[model samples]
Structure formats: C-alpha cells, structure tokens
Target: MTVRPAWLLPKGQTREDTRLAPVGTWAPDGEIRTRDGVVPGGQPFAATGVAAMQLQIGVGRAAVQGTTAQGAYPIAVDAPETLNFTDGNAQFARIDSVILRVYDGLFDESEQPLARVEIVEGEATATPTAPTLPPCSLRLWDVTVPAGASAGVGGIDWGSALADRRRYTTAVGGIIPTGWGLSFAGAYDGQYRDADGVLERWNATDATWETYRAPEPPVETITGGLSVASGWSLSSFDARRRAGVVQFLGMFARTGATLPANPNIGDTLVATLPAGWRPIVLLEALCSNGYGFGAAAVGGDGKITIRSWAGGNNVSGIEKDTNVRISAAFVQ
Candidate 1:
C-alpha cells in the first residue's frame, strides 16, 4: 500500500483519517465563511510565496433548444488572448524587461520551447481601467548590427553587401526613361545618369544638367599673324577660343598724317574669320584727338567692318594719327 503525503492535498483541503477533503468536512474549526465571500482565518494552511500563476480561461457557450442538453455548454475553445494591463489614469508605466515563453501544441523538454527575452526600456500609458502599450520604438528586423553595438543604435546598413549601393558607381548600359536622373559620387562626383543613360552633371549657375565631359578639351588659340588692310596697320591682336566659339580683339593704327576732326573711316578688316564661321562685331572704335566715335558690323564675307563718324555725321578739324580697335566673336 502506498501512503500519500500531507502536502499533496488540494488547496483549502486537509488530511483527516489520513484522507484530504473539503475544509469543514475534515475539521470542525475549518469553517467556510459565508459573509463578504471571503475565506475565514485560522485555516491552518498557508503558502510561503507564489512563484508563478497559471490561468486557463474558459470559453463562453451558446444555448440550443433541441434534444437533451438544455443549457449551452462550450463547443469550441479559443486560444488564450494576450493579457493586457491598464491603470486608466492617463499616466505612463515603465517596464525594464520582459520574458516570453513560446511553445508549440505541447510544451515539454522534447519540444524545446523558445524563450524570447527583451531587455529594452519601454513605457505604457496609464489611463483609467486598461493601459495601452505603444509599439516598439525602434525596428531593426533586417539590420546587421554589430555585436557590441548599443540597443539604441539600429538602422539598415547602407554599405552592406546585401544592399545594391554599387549600382550608382557607373551608368547602366540599359535604356532608361526620359527625364530620369540619378546622382552618384566618387569617379562620378557631381555626375548623374540621364534618362538616355547618358552621364551628366549639375550646372548650378545655369540651373541645369550639362553633359559630363571627361578630361575637358583644352581651349584653342589662333595667332592672326598681323594683317594690315585698307591703310590700317595692326598694332596688337588677341584671340581666344572656348568651346565652339572664338573671340578676337584687334587694335589698328594709320597715323603720321593730320586729318579732319571726327573723320569717317570706311571698310576695315578688324579681323578675319575662320571658314564656315561668321564674325559678330562687339565694339568698334576710332580714338583720335580727345574723343572717338565708330560703329562696327559683320560684312557678307565674315569680315568685321568699322566706320567712324562725328556726331553721327562726317566732321572736319581732326587730329593726326588715329587708333582703331575692334572686338568681335566668331561662331560656327
């Protein structure tokens, strides 16, 4: 025969004649309190401390008017719902950490249930009856965080091998949509790919994107070699080439003889133009005596013509030795 231990009895039950039963059924002093729905003191059973509490919630049932079962009984039981705690005071309650144990259908050593322990500082609003906990403050589901990194530091790794950041290093060889642009760095600094897959750069001054030029072409310069035409001798000449345009500045002199004041000078080759290029005169001058007056124009043969007049008309009483300089640009 096996002998049962006294501690094996159910709660509020005791051993009498070596048998555990209800409180009043076993002992006269153990009486069930009727008032206040509270248990009476001096029950002889006391717990040291509660280590854990397990609750199995029952499902509500419906009523059926059919055959034998009169009252409704639970037909199907739902999985336990998540427990919620609230103070309903509109204040906040903080929790330093929480440990959650997860299991499959049955929990046992063979099942090896998982233990998820979170150690982040979190708070819940304390309104009135039920408190509400906010969602996680930080989300790092796919983040590759360092081992020793702090919990506060979490983000998607931009330079990670998992990311396709290298796509911007060079322009894609495939076709792209119109007006689509991409900005990159390194060898492509200030450069971008246009909709046509063509590389370009932002021109802040122009407020637009210009075709990117690798090793920009050097500016071209041409020496006119000094040409004197129509009694006009070349004094100095300067020419500069930039992109698709060229500009020239030429000074001419036909002095050593006194002439009428504000004399009108005709047709002069301020400068010659390159083939297929036309010259657009910017400034024409005839500096003689104390004042000068001249006008420049583009001739039919791409030559710059300068004509001088006094007060908009031919004048008399001029000085000796006059200087004429012409500034013009040639564009193809």
Candidate 2:
C-alpha cells in the first residue's frame, strides 16, 4: 500500500500556503502552536480597530505570511487572551481596544502609547495624541533622548552630540539660510534660543525676541542761581524760556546794597549768571521803590550787566537799598 503526500491531500492544501496564511491554534498552555511547532511574537508591534483587530503594517493592508513578506497577525480586541511563547510564558492578556501595553528589556512596563492616545476619543475630543519635540538648546537640532531630554519635565543636555550648537550653515559653500536650525519656534512659550543661539524672552509689545526698551521719562525742570549782595533778599528766581545755549531768568529781590550815583552804560549787577550761561536777552524789569526799569543783559562771561536806562533811571540814589526785579535771558 502506498500513501499520498500531505500536499496531495485536502487537509495538507490548507497548510500549503502557510507562508501566505499561517494557521495555528491557541493552546491551553497559552501557546500558539502550528502542526510543526510554536512561533514567537516579534514586537514593537502596532495594531488598531475594535473587535477582530489585526496587526497592521502601513495602514489597512492584511498581513501576508512568509519569511520575507510582511504579515499582520490577527487577534480579537474585545477578548482577554494572551499570545503565548514557545517557552510557555504568556506575553499578555485582557488587552482591549486601545489598551496595548509596551514592555522593556526586563519585560517591565515601559509605555502604553495606545492607552495614552485614547484621550483623543474622549467626550470633548482635543488634539490627537502625538509626539512633541523642541528643536534647539545651546544649539539647533531634533531633540531626542540623552540629547534634548530624557523624559517628561526633563532638561536638555547640551553636551550631547545629537544637538547642533554651531552657527547653522546650509552647505560648506558658506551659504547661510534664514531659519535654518530651529523649527516650530512659536509653539513654545517663555524663553527660547534666538537665531544667534542667545537665550531670549518674547517681548509682547513688539511681538519679537529682538531688542526692546521702555519709554523715556518726560522732560523736567532745571533751576540754578547765584548769591545776591548783602542785605538783598533773593526771594524766588525762575528760568522759563530757552534760547541758543541760554535760559531766560526772572528774579525778585529786596535790595540794600549801594549803587553808583550815575551808573555807566555797562554797569555790572551784584547777581551773576550760572556757569556756562550768559544773559543775551532782557525782556522786562520792575522796582517797588518806583526806580526806573533798567536795561539788563548777560555777557558771554556770564556777568549780569545792568545798563543805565532812559526810563526808571534811579541809579544815582533812588535805586540804592531798594526793592527791585530783574529779567534777562542767558545763553551758554
């Protein structure tokens, strides 16, 4: 009696394209066993959808079986089931929609990217869960572990080789491009690195991180004076007008000083102009003693010159020891 080959039989035909579609059974020992033996599951794997979920490669293509051809393993997302290993260790179980857990080298829980991403399906859905990164530090580059940050709320390590700290250049041909290093710069708040790598803060007023300055204060009042002769009360004096290197000054005085009987045309007064100031213009002058108003001027030497005047000319005697007012504009 001769026996036919398994490929020639109906039961064997199903196993013929195991490369295209591998069929296996879940063992009570939590192992996925084929007619030959058990196969191990390779991970960092990705799958999606609700019930009858499949391990997808690109988007929604069914997985083809082969040593070379990529294939997605099929599994039910609603059920609590563990895909077992050949060593009899169950990888995991009770995995439902969007609740996939990741394991590290020691088989410890590393991350749950799927579970964290489920918030995107929340009642008031927000932005989709995704990765975020900043592009610069002491330098500009794609941020990553050991370079940009280790984990959440972590600081960037500038010493890491992955960060680019040098002045960014397009090619070795000395072609410099605008905004060559950093990316998505506006997405961040607070402090950031400028194009020159200088740490700077955002100026809300100008909407830039460039140079900014506060406004200057308003112009102020400036006052100065000199001592009056003995018995002369220099009550109040003010300079209200401006000229070329000069200030217009007005003064009120109670006088007691002696005066020349017949004052000369260029008679100097007791009061002196401040340094760097000279009386160039005289507007008015008045005396309480009814003395004639005198013509006043400031010389370039800052000397107050009270010239004998035609009217109110009491310089001989009536002007002596009398109340007087003087007004003159000075120039520096």
Against the true structure, whose TM-score is highest? 1
Question: Which regions of candidate 2 deviate over 4 angstroms?
Answer: 1-220, 241-245, 252-254, 257-266, 279-291, 311-321
Which candidate number maximizes lDDT?
1
lDDT of 2 by residue, 177-278 (tens): 223344422212333333454445444455565432335544323466665645456666665433343344445453654554364435646476565455
Clashes of 1: 15
Q: In candidate 2, list every pair of residues with a backbone clash.
A: 19-65, 63-72, 245-332, 246-330, 246-331, 278-331, 279-298, 292-312
Tell me the TM-score of model 1.
0.34
Per-residue lDDT tens digits of candidate 1, residues 1-332?
11111222234322341342122211110132110011112311111111111112222111111112111111111222222212211244332221111222232233532222122323443321111212211110111222222323332122440111101111223212232124322222253434356666655566566777788667877656543555556777777777667677666675545334335545545455454445443433333323555566655455666565453223453333566556666564
True lDDT of residue 6, candidate 1: 25
Which stretches in model 1 have alpha-carbon errors above 4 Å?
A: 1-192, 195-216, 256-290, 311-320
TM-score of each: 0.34, 0.27
Cα deviation of 45, candidate 1, in Å = 77
